[model samples]
Target: MATLGFIGSGNIGTNIARLAVAAGIDVVLSNSRGPETLAATVAELGERARAATPEEAARAGDWVVVSIPLAAYEQLPVAALAGKVVLDTINYYPYRDGRVEALDTGKSTTSELVQEHLAGAKLVKAFNNISDFHIPSLARPAGAADRTALPIAGDDPRASADAADLISRLGFDTVDAGPLTESWRFEPDTDPYAMPYSAEPDAMRAFWAAAGEAIRSGTAPQTPPHVDQGVPLTAARLRTLLADTPRKLTADRLVA
Candidate 1:
């Protein structure tokens, strides 16, 4: 089995590790907090998973996943990740990541910044648009009636294809969203960001309506109800959503 390394073992990272383990892959998980902090997660993942430092994880796997916060991109070990195929699952949230002048100005995409940071790595933008909690919920076997497809972007076509193949093994299908510069097609707030995989827009709207009514009536729960199930997204459907989206971020909404 192939080994997968993770540089961040938060919700999405651990979930991806789960899927990879299920698909017969070994996983090395790490986080900013250190490997010892991940003991519980490693135990839950069984024998195929182990915890290591970020650099060790990067160097140990044939392929590595970089799922850290966008602001921390510069902290990635460039030399360790050199010449490696890296799957980037980062998205920018100005409020949370502070602000990047380029992203604010539409001058660069998140993956572009990451690729620039990991100059020698083969970077592919992926898994950024889906909700962390919805990953395993939406994955389906290849060619299944409800297989979900994700969009990936990278400058190198071969790297993108390899990423697509690896992601396929993990359960979901993939659609190339062009190069890293074009990756914003699936980034935060875009048409394809979260809805297509969560549920159809109509379904989401209905859920919101009911939630609003419950809130207004003072009958809402402490937490909002999750959409009952996800709607599968086909590659063609994902392509159309990506095509229909026009860049929404314009001038940099600068922050202090």
Candidate 2:
């Protein structure tokens, strides 16, 4: 089994670890606080799980998952994560991450910023749109009629495909939402962000289709629109991390 390391084991990170362990994957979990502080989480995950420092967790896994807030991206050890397949499950929340002038000005995407930091890792964007309350509830059999679909975006074809396969094995379908640049389509303010994973896939697709149609027809409700493009996660000493990249393919090949 591949070792899964999580750099920040909070709600989404812990839940991903739980799901991975239930599926028989070994997990190395860590948080910003320290391994000693993650005792309860490691204990809850049993023998398949262990606690380690952030860098140790990054170094331990075949695939590393970065689930910390965007503000703490610099704290992630980029050198240790070199050559690993990284799953970025973070989304930008201006209120929580503080304001990134670029994001505020519709200039960049959060995933791009993280990618710039982990220059040696094959980064894929996923798990960002769904809320913590819905993650566990979304799991279903691979081909179950009501299975959920999770979108994954990234630059590397193999990495994205591998992520899709792992996601399917973990009980959901994968929708390739395009490159890291297109990840904004699935960001926090978009319909796909929080509306679909907890519901049926078909329903979710229908929702996006409708939203697109509405946007084209000028029937969409006036709400805060999703920032139109991807942004680098950070610009200076204080910033660096976050979500997905896209794989170019026929429109039909977009979803798994």
Candidate that would win on TM-score: 1
For model 1, residues 1-256, the per-residue Cα lDDT tens digits are 6999999998899989999999999999999999999999999999999999999999998789999989898999999999999999998866557667889888999999999989999999989888776788988788888889999999999999989999998999998989998998998768898777765566654654565456555685244355446778889999999999988783332211
lDDT agreement with native, every candidate: 0.86, 0.72
Give TM-scores for every candidate, taking all chains together and pairing residue i with residue i: 0.89, 0.76
The lDDT leader among the candidates is 1
Kindly report the root-mean-square deviation of model 1 from the true structure over all alpha carbons.
4.9
RMSD of each: 4.9, 11.8
Clashes of 1: 1
Off by over 4 Å in 1: 200-224, 250-256
Q: Candidate 1, clashing residue pairs?
A: 104-252
